[model samples]
Target: MTPIARTRARAVETLSLDATATRNALSSALVSGLADALTDCGKDPEVRAVVLTHTGTTFCAGADLRDPPAPEALVDLLRQIIELPKPVIARVTGHVRAGGLGLLAACDLAAASREATFAFTEVRIGVAPAVISLCVVPRTDPRALARYYLTGERLDPAEAVRLGLLTTTAEDVDEALSPILDGLRRSSPQALAETKRLLTAKVLETFDRDAADLTALSARLFSSAQAREGMTAFLERRDAAWVV
Candidate 1:
């Protein structure tokens, strides 16, 4: 099945994470599909902006344990979203976890439904949110991230907004995004692209500086004994040995 479904409304192109059976997990195939879609949008004259959304109760349940992408691939996908010439907006109306947060952080703007939830669950699985921190750390409030990243605590939409993980939260997410999309449509393509570069320059710099180290750390940790135990326990619907 196609993991990404593309649709358009005038100048706004929407790319949906359509792998509902996996809760849109970032398997290698889904990552490649999304990257290719974003690449096409970046070069398309009619696409002034892109909306990245999902089709299940979970926006993304993080990496697909059974078929995880290479850490480097995840890093490149996040960087691609940040560097895409057309603005990418995350429209989340469901739960997001672990590496999924990286996707949200990479977007130029994000809006979520009040029912949406978020968490950095890597710690619970004996790995750290390493690769994602490249975008997540710089964009979110450091103090809030410190708490959530360490504890793997769940955050509601309002708290996510307070932590700078979301642009806004509304009972109807699409209504909230309508005006933003309208404004994007009215703006000049060159002006929007230049302004996005200005906004994302700091983020791109962090990626350039820390991506290699973070990807290495992620690869090392995911292959660790602790992660093996945690993943096994999780698959078995039990707690890891370290859990008290």
Candidate 2:
């Protein structure tokens, strides 16, 4: 098992991202491990819930772009997380940025430490927050989306809760998530699954109608010289010389 693939059991199955120094960045191994964990948990009647947490201080820094997975692999892992039959809780502690924020959004519920911070930071790095955007769009407030997506500013836990990114702030990581797990334990697993299905269907209904348009827009953005320039400038730590 790679450093990224680490699992421990609390009362429930606790899957911790083990890339601590990298702030538990979503490396390919970690993504695969996470998907597998969720699949296994879904099959186990004994596992009432899954808690997705990290080993170190930080929750997750975001995707490990340095060793990024193929787009298909990335999508598959994210879909597994989103579609898991059992409830998944995001146990956020430190900073959740870019794709990390998206992971939190993908979970059925998120509990963050009062000190945790979040950001939709893809714009700062020049790429659109494409995959995570699908997860975040429905969860976040429409009014705040434009600013956060464009500016890539960090939002504190309080702000994250206000914007629906977090269920609530915890005094500490364990305290924040204890009640959520307790509540899930007492609830009907079958009913939870059904509710998740219903909510997912409703949330996806809006995008199902506009899929083609969205794809075309994304393709155009990717093909543009401005996008290339922005990306290059970000990587080089220089200003982008956009024509317009």
Candidate 3:
């Protein structure tokens, strides 16, 4: 399969981020491919819901900064997911970081495996979760987001659920998700679409209002001297300059 591909089962569309090589980082191609796939699913009458998932152990590791980071695309992708007429469910069975957290926040519902872990790791690399904050800030616990975003603290599943980042956590992802899917299947597609618009209106407003400024904030941080040192140290497997 391609880096991002869509398949269907029982009126549900599964959008799989299949690039395990980079821990399914949001490369430009992968992000665009996913947006396009979601658009296609929205237009298909047979697709009642969407399941956003990954094929490997790490659901997503965040931006692929090997190239100059273009965070505008990630902002757009999160907007797309949040505003999509069909309900999107994040099925996280592994680790998620940085921008990946935005994807979960934008989804209408999300479930993670008990073994899955998460972190807002951008601060450690000297950037903030500026762009993703449009979605995450609203869905996340203020105290939790404040602590984790600043400290880059990793949260286990229960903490994640308590932090309002996940709907449920279980050892069995399929079991955790079965009821949601069944309920989604029982709903009328039109009602689901309209309800999604109602649910997401404020988040979409947040995106439209704050995206450009946040993108600029993220871009500036990525290009900063501190971020340069931090990223370089991370790549070299050494402590960052500020680690003292």
Considering lDDT, where higher is better, how would the candidates rank from best to worst? 1, 3, 2
TM-score of 2: 0.84
For all candidates in order, the CA lDDT equals: 0.95, 0.74, 0.89
Global lDDT for candidate 1? Answer: 0.95
Candidate 2: misplaced stretches above 4 Å?
A: 3-11, 206-244
**lDDT per residue (tens digit) for residues 1-244 in model 3:** 4688678899999999988988898887788888889889878999999999998899989887774337888887888888888899999999999989988998999999988999998988899999989999888789877999999989998999999999999999889899999999999999999999988888888988999899999989998999999889878989898997
* Winning model by TM-score: 1
**Per-residue lDDT tens digits of candidate 1, residues 127-155?**
99999999999999999889999999999
Using TM-score as the measure, what is the rank order of every candidate, best first?
1, 3, 2
- TM-scores for all candidates: the values are 0.99, 0.84, 0.97
C-alpha lDDT (0 to 100) for residue 152 of candidate 2: 85
Whichever of 2 and 3 has more TM-score, that candidate is 3
lDDT per residue (tens digit) for residues 114-211 in model 2? 88888876676556777666668888898877888888898898888888888888788787677778888888889988888887774455345544
